[model samples]
Target chain A: MNLLKEVFMKYGYFPGCSQTGSAKEYDISLRKVIEKLGVSFDEIEDWSCCGATSAHVTNHKLSTALAMRNIMLAEQQGMENIIAPCAACYNRLIMSQFEIANHSGIRKETEELLSASFQKDVKVFNVLELFLNIGIDKIIENRKRELNDLKVACYYGCLLVRPSGLTKFDDAEQPESMEKIAEATGAKTIDWNYKVECCGAAHSIARRDIVVDLSKKILDDAKYHGANVMIVACPMCHTNLDMRQRVMKRTYPEHEDFPVLYITELIGLALGMDEKELGIDLHFIDFNYKDLVPENSGVG
Target chain B: MSVNTLKETNKLLASFVPPASFTDEEQEPLNTSVQLHRHNIADEISERTFQDVSLCYQCGKCSSGCPVRYYMDIAPNKVVRLIQLGFYEEALKSSTPWLCAGCQTCSARCPKEFDLAKFMDAVREIAIEKGIEVKEKNILKFHKAFLDQIKSHGRSYEAGLVAEYKMKTLDLLQDVDSAPGMYLKGKLAILPHNIKDRKGVKSIFKKTSGK
Candidate 1:
């Protein structure tokens, strides 16, 4: 019996803009994976966008206000912890929480504007955070299938661990939280740098050239370390690394079909969940698990 | 730093590619009028965010550790020094701030705890506000397109942003090759998603943008 089955049963969910729009596959796989883990979610109703990289880059006030709306909305729903899947959304929400709680000026200004009291008690967790706490024992116990053959490069991709103050749940320089989570899903983890490197998140839209160059370096490092698949927590990283792998061809000509999967989708596969149920076919890169996940591993 | 780390840094530095106009900046004089302009700009930066650039000492820690430094017009530490010495125009006009991926590598490794990434952001913001012709135009264009999309719809519309960006920049065929694959993978959603408190969102933007 898995201890997490009862211990981690329910959570408040906040799927950011991309979860509904561009990266629907993350939402689908995340839901299925969590359900199999016996975890239920009370999603915040009518949640707005988290004012991601765009808001913070241009207007700090607007960025905090947008995140404040969601925090207040979740508190209204009587939830203390929210499971936001997108890395950009998680970064904004968590950092905003840190700001409002510590700085009285920002807090007072935001509260008056939102017409809701700011509470420092409310906690925001990205899916990676939750998985880090979900322990390897339970993960191993729940595995119905094993990803024995696939060498995965766990890409933390800038948001999961950075800035050294807020959202620094793991080592800011060298994080192993994602590696632990990936290993629990029976995937072989590789040893390579470029874990917390930026994938040119919002720059994916305007400056594909920059993103292509940055992401190519990351992919080349992963490939050099003998990784066939790269696992990422951020949807933006997936969009840049996996979807834009073709664009990176000019830099790395010999690069092959590299699938960038959300950590939740990999967890779902380990739990013997179906591909369609997890929206596996929705990847821009052709990702067939059978090609990577070998049958009769004899280890599982 | 340890011996191994110093050796590693030297190896990385050996492969460093300086920008095209690196020697020109050294040749150009930081005249009295330019110094005054820079001083005023530094005061504005401090007044805006209360982040003191004078506290920064030239350790070169930020520069050595910066991943994108190879592609930068000036080193990250030098940008801080440029601000301290009152060279605001040089720092702003450089491709360094625009190319910053905001990965926080420099911030994480800063000995004096100065945020190099945030400083770059402030520099970029001032550049945009001043209507300075950026070294990286498409980078500026992309940021403008998203803000334009968000001001209209409460959130980013992927298709709308791409279309608007392409139309504005007239780089229609830039990444056109990737669109068909994106649509097929359900990565490109056509409909714009609006939240219920959109008016509230608009008010926030209105106040911030001062429109």
Candidate 2:
């Protein structure tokens, strides 16, 4: 707890585009959970898009330049550390930092395009990394009640850990960081196969069938492993897994309803925060907190 | 040796010889068919992305782990093979690059540490630059609409992106059921959040587009 307090006194927050619109619950829950944990963050001023999958799919330079602009903003604001809640934004910001520091061609082109000096000074951390730095014991000590009734499958998804050379946080293949944090809240974290599987990502809008097919497999794997709720770290993963269940039910009528909650939302629930306060009520899949908490747990 | 064993050995060796009709002239025509006109696409991709397609040994680990490979017209390993063989047109025309979600599962599992996801990005970029017809037109339209939203507001506007994408691809009816639910949850902000430095973002678009 002392280490957690010392390390994350204040930092920059990059709440990627989805947090404001599609995944508002993620933002809401993250804020409430982090506030309870005594972590503070200042949003980078006037930050633009991190040039997500769309930017990199069509143009390489634009992707690097757009991410660099946010890094520049953080550096100018004197933030030594920045946390990107979205896995895609964190990946792009870290990738851009790596490219600017190592690749001279990208560095020069990005500097020229943004007309700003590239200072690879600010370090980037994903939401999971932030929790890990905050220490699992600290999380356990802060929790007001144990999640005894919750069977959780911690889904890391793709961008958070893959292409290990860039993000370089956890084991890309078999990540246990989410499970470690999840177990600290006293939930039964299941050992699942589709933890790092792709949820069809941005294709949720363009190609609904593919997203439905892939997300269905993930949901089915979680259910088979006895996980009643799927926990995710990325907004994209949440959208594909949580919001696309309707399409999944239509495609496979026998598909059962499974709740998907952000890791922060799960922590908030264990911390005695109500579902409405953590924005868990906003999820597309219905989740009643009373089903999990016991009568004497003191959480209404 | 026994006489029966010697006869068996001779019979087996006899089957190893080529038929009398298979002449050296016939083999020469096979060589002509192998004389394919190869392009320098591998070098071009290497130059842009700093990834060498020649490093791929076609282990098929990338294709096996890919979640969306079933939907791709060409498998990921086959796409790399096409690039290595300098079949730029075939590689560019493949739906594999467009359908790739940049999941990086292939890149993470590759024995040779080939960045196949970045390679897919480079292929998509080069294909768009060369004005090749996009095989996944709706996917391309979605990407374009997403970028246009950023260009206008400096951040993504979900409602505007959906409206623009539907207008472009005429995919209006799909996902319409989810809209009212999203609106009810306050997930869809009707107005865009314009950044203070809109001019800076627009300049980035202009400069990156090489205007």
Candidate 3:
């Protein structure tokens, strides 16, 4: 752990559509946390969507080309590592690198499409993965404020842990990386089975019943396990858990609308970040965790 | 998944079939050509998804771990089995691949390290390519709508995505309750975010999709 000393690493941040739209709070909190930690990042200029479910499901070639464009852009910026806050984009971007590197035919196809050759130069990491590399102890030591007695259920959803060949990170079967990161902020993490469960993403609009059925179960488990706040990394997961509570409640009328915070937002709060700076007020459900933790109180 | 779960897998698969419902076409047609056809489909799968279908040994681990199994017409493991059995038409027609959430649970849980997610994704792709009608109309609409947004602006435009999706599915009032909350929370933008590489995105789709 001696190499854990604070070191400057620059990453090209590729914010998915949700980060600018549904999960803007994620972007805001990410900015605050990274700033507080003295971490520097550059937004990959002219970055495009990673073709999350659409390209992959419809046309495999289209999917690889779209991700290849973003990776090439990051490389063009002289950056070797790129990070995405959205799980869907992160999966696609990383998978794009993997696809173009291993599959010569697909790589040639993509290279022809973009009229640009893809070198196995850039690597993609989710923001959570980036922080885990930064060391959880360093994060804890950097905390300006501690969330004492705040019970949180850390939800990884999917994409962060699967298709192990591409993601190449986290235990696919039972992942505790996010839980460990959340606990570093001085919050209590509830152990739960649905940590890596699917929240029926992208189906939020078309097949909402799926999202309702799936997200409701995740929320119910988190609540049942005494979690007052839910922490997530993917913007899609955040939307299903935070924005779609009203829709989910149609099936379960008694379902309480719980606040879902991004990993960065939780880290920012633990760092004593200004509420507005973290964009905490923009949640669909009221963030009512202040009462759970005594104001300005030290670790209980 | 394992030999230990064979009893449970059989019981589950049995629940779906009516007792003694095997009709005149119900012969266990494992002929020589059928065997060739089976290997042909397996070869096609390997070429498409880069997954060795031979690695699978009828283990139902994929179906057991699938979160959306309750809604699938055939379970995740069964789709691979159907392909391995040369039932390409049956696998393509089934609602299983379309219903897949792409959660990668099946891929993660496969004991043989078979890429079930990619296999299912490839099935959906083949289904579309062959003009097989998807039983899940709304999901198809959603994917088409999502791709449409990406194709035009080189990024997703939420307002445009919703408008186009609603137009395609004709479920205008569907999930309308979440809109007000989403808009009020600043979760949606009225305009699409454009990437300067719009031509690059369009060409990528045009070249790869063969459209």
Candidate 4:
């Protein structure tokens, strides 16, 4: 029927650690939206954490093994393309694939360690890239209700842009696909300095003081630029901005909370899905969605 | 080494960052797009990771506790500084990456939230790809043994890991004293444990394979 529908689309989706536990909104909304696009996502069963920052540091083989294990699972499922919503997850996954592929001996070694040889053929796409592949025109055509002049800021954090070779999606310094996707859904996008800045990711757990300061800058920049919502593709960024705001307020006592929405939730809303269906209420930073919802809604 | 010598070495290492042009002919150019695209490795550091590096202020916080700094020909802080200065060649070549213990002490204490360990790992990946000979053989041997454990178990098994490691290094007899300690401390067992997610792990391995 549609390009998205006609493609017989099927892919493996690696939700990473944050999406499974913390960013429940992104995990729920992403599945629903992709389903709406007539795509089927087969999540790799028993996927382990991608080792994030710590594994790579402590041990190279371990870090690569962490990522390589996931890739191996995806390949076994015969799904060549994977949609990874987390930026860090995407970068590490893609980086591991390339590193293993270029080094034959390492690949052999990894094969021995994991009990499987990776094909290195799998492609990992972040949410934006997946949506781009699904065609913005199709999403726009599918939209029944237009976003009501909602001013949103697209936050890339760092993983999505840098290590551009791994992402191969957008500019490292300032990525606009998230913004473009927002615009395609009929919403206004804002230009902010903190677009590609760090969100003090893992530091949120071990070092709150630093994350608080970094989050303050990002939230303050978004609010200062007159953005009503900050749209992000990273679960960690969402957690820091959306969930960690209370801590930030307690620590700083000066900053106010700004709602952070995953890109999929915004797209689902703009595509006429219900708010509850997108798990909007799960966010820590409260936003009055009634004000944002139109007179008639599909997602009640 | 004494505290004073450590500090003296730290100072010498601090100047190692902003690495001078490659002194060795064996050193390969670190940042080429073809290599980056061919392998899909990020050619440049992410500004976020870089911002963490910028926080160092060249304080040597990471260098002081680094266990291998004494043995290392380069300093950990200087490695961070070098990457900060975009002298990736020297940074990648330095033995710092393989030396990381994966302890988050430096990452935890980083005044700027910089992850020196993660940066080293990234550089290590690049180095391995360039086939730049590692300064030491144990790192390479360890990598091989670790992977071998995974291949047999569909996940890592500590006993399998140690055994394969000992075999690959051809030094099974060398760590004999640790054998009694490993068994006594419940660190090693006569048999390896079966991996929990064999099928799933197998599937994961299949997808990321190059061919």
What RMSD does each model have against the real structure?
Answer: 7.3, 9.0, 6.1, 14.2
Which candidate achieves the best TM-score against the true structure?
Answer: 2
lDDT rank, highest first? Answer: 2, 3, 1, 4
For model 2, name the residue pairs that clash. none
User: In DockQ, how does model 1 score against the reference complex?
Assistant: 0.42
Give the distance in Å from residue A14's predicted Cα in candidate 3 to where it truly belongs.
0.9
**If both were scored by TM-score, which would come out higher, candidate 2 or candidate 4?**
2
- Model 3, runs deviating above 4 Å: A1-8, A294-300, B1-40
Best by DockQ: 2
Task: State the C-alpha lDDT per candidate.
Answer: 0.77, 0.86, 0.80, 0.68
Tens-digit lDDT string for candidate 1 (B100-119): 87777888888877787777
Task: Give me the chain B TM-score of candidate 1.
Answer: 0.79
lDDT comparing candidate 2 with the true structure: 0.86
- Candidate 2 matches the true fold with a TM-score of 0.91
lDDT of 1 at A94: 80
lDDT, model 4, position B120: 70
Q: For the second chain of model 2, what is the TM-score against the true structure's chain B?
A: 0.81
For residues A1-300, what per-residue lDDT tens digits would candidate 3 score against the true structure? 433443336678898878888888999889778877767789999999989988888788888888888888887787777789899998888777887778899888887888887654887889778898767987888988778677989898888877776666678767788888888888888887789899998777877888889999999898888888899899889888887888767788898778888889888888888667788888887774465667676443
- Residue pairs whose backbone atoms clash in candidate 3: none
Each candidate's DockQ: 0.42, 0.67, 0.64, 0.06
